[model samples]
Target: MNPLLPIRHFVPDTEARVMPDGRLYLYGSYDISRETTYCSDILHVFSTDDLVHWTDHGAALRSQDIPWASEGHLLYAPDCIYQDGTYYLYFCMTGSYEGVAISDSPAGPFHHPVPITPADRDSIDPAVFIDTDGQAYYFWGQFHLRGSKLNPDMITLDVSTLNTCIIDEKNHGFHEGISIRKRNGIYYLLYTDISRGKATCISYAMSDSPLGPYKKGGVIIDNINCDPNTWNNHGCMAEYKGQWYVFYHRSSQNSKFNRRVCIEPIFFDERGYIAEVPMTSQGAEPPLSAGVPISAALACQMMHGLFISPAADNTTEILSHATNGSWAAYRYLSFDAPKSFSITAAAAINGGTVEIWADSLLLGSCLVTPTGGWDIYRTFRCPLTPVTGVKTLYLVFRGNDLKRRLMDVKEFCFYGDCGSGNAD
Candidate 1:
């Protein structure tokens, strides 16, 4: 599997929540790959137990499905929370007006989306927090931060209780994308702050109540150059199985509009301050076990012409557009003892080799054999040079003719002498 590949593209403005069932669910703005738009007009939900494999729950809501929403307006940041045996999804539409939808399930084809925030308010990026006392609060804004205590219905906010300046842009750097979460009795307000650098950084403020009195808590992550055109960052934090994580997005394909979601493990010190987290290819979990079935879609990195995309039957395969130096990389797999690797792939033409490497060391190569058709699948194997312990894996697709497409890789696994601490 591409162990660290983004769950699906193009997911931006991520809000991660751990459902009562223990699975992590993702809510974000979706965009078509290589599209010019910042986000699409629909939302798709994805869930996972381990970060490696994700199941798409299909479209949760669509702008066209909302009677008040314009057909092609951008579907910006969204959020979801569970309370009273019901799940509520909040999102911002084209005009920056917010709305709410209700569903019995977390992964929903949510229904009855009625406008919440007034049309006059400049609202986007809605964040919902349910407090320990059963009180729910809704937060949203762009240039300025505004919030209010939500009514029992979880959709409407009391106009009298609204604070249109919970944390202003000038004071707390709250440009947009606000997320609220509580830990150890501390109310944390996370958002995009422009005070740091060229692109927005993930900064936070702390409060004693759901609607603060917030004090600047400093930055939790700085702006990054994940892609040369990277512009802004937006995300949320959730604790899963006693581990805390930061969910964020980065622009890719050299376009600021084409963003992909990424995550990293985060920590709060004994003093209750969060340390900054750096972007990494290793991802949020421990090294995956060797010799286990790994989806080719888990590639942590892919060079040009190499894409993990769906095939004719709607299953994913490595689209190897045989350009010179096209490659895919999966990082940090644990191997306790020596082993050989095998790959399952399909190719209509022969002459390219799947070059395997462990870190900087070349393990071996498997020659691509003609399989009668591009969709015809077959297994190929090659002996390794006995690499031990944990190491990054690189699969380079090199062909005798650089201009033609290589082969589609379905999956890969390792096998050989038994060794402790190797792939489970």
Candidate 2:
């Protein structure tokens, strides 16, 4: 599966940090199904070593675990950092109050969440950055970018040193979702802005100091097309294994609340200007080869009436909700000749076919027969038209009843020699 595909349900507001043990750990707000609320009082942490496979470190911290947090408070965006063998988790609740938690491990059952922000200063999206000189800074805000020097305990902010208006949003395009990271001694402040359009776009600002009277950079990511109905964008940046990645979210299930995390590689120019990172289907991982099982959730684009959900076996099921024109596509496949492919699915509808297309040309298709139940599984095989080189693969579902589902497709794979000795 593509690393960008959410492990389960909507896990938005991603904050990625490469921990001391060299694994990339992800902490994000967990949404319940397709609810409009931010989160369901708990957060899960996921860690990946190779960027291809990830392990879910379930229930890192729950709102009930925090004593001072308001009752039934929704856990919003959170950030975790390792300092002195302890993990410090900075988080926000529905009331927009900031809190800090402590854990002995990176992926943790974090405990002891204490409110850090003052009662008068209500804000969300907390980001903490530690400088090279061993000084730690805390940031949180919406329209006005704010920060303060943290006490050595990392649980308390130096309220006397708080700068409530560090960067003016009117000049810098900072609306919300602040993330701080340093590269080459330049402090980069990445945040969500509505300067380009109504949709939240990830913009950046750079300065030489942690407390930045920073200069506005440019948009690192734009969420206008992330989803047809994308409402906002939230993300963070991290450099892993000599490569830089921008982590963001995309709305799914035809709702803005069901946003999923996504990532794409980014690069810096010689002048240290970070390039604009565009959203892609082939996230973080390298281009997929022919034999790798392409998860339906990783479909480059789904049009007509297609959707995805988690299925058994850790796979994503592509739901063909009626409409013969409905199609899902996987980008960039290498083929040598007329190769055979197989689809794993279960269809309750009879005589439906998954028409395959290489690039724009129609290939063959796999017949989907009635399996009694949608959960009943079957493997359908078919051959494609002779093709060579690289091209995008499109699977269009054909059936009657424009309002009914066709089948539940788990995955598809090409097994024959389709060129290329190795694929990443």
Error of 1 at 421 (Å): 33
What shift in Å separates residue 57 of candidate 2 from its native position after superposition?
3.2
What C-alpha lDDT do the candidate models reach, one value each? 0.77, 0.76
What is the model-wide C-alpha lDDT for candidate 2? 0.76
| The best candidate in terms of TM-score | 2
Residue 297's lDDT in candidate 2: 60
Error of 2 at 29 (Å): 1.6
Clashes of each: 7, 0
Query: Over 4 Å off in model 2, which ranges?
Result: 1-6, 34-36, 119-121, 159-161, 166-173, 196-200, 222-229, 310-316, 322-327, 340-383, 396-409, 415-424
Tell me the spans in candidate 1 whose CA falls farther than 4 Å from its real position. Answer: 1-8, 119-121, 288-424
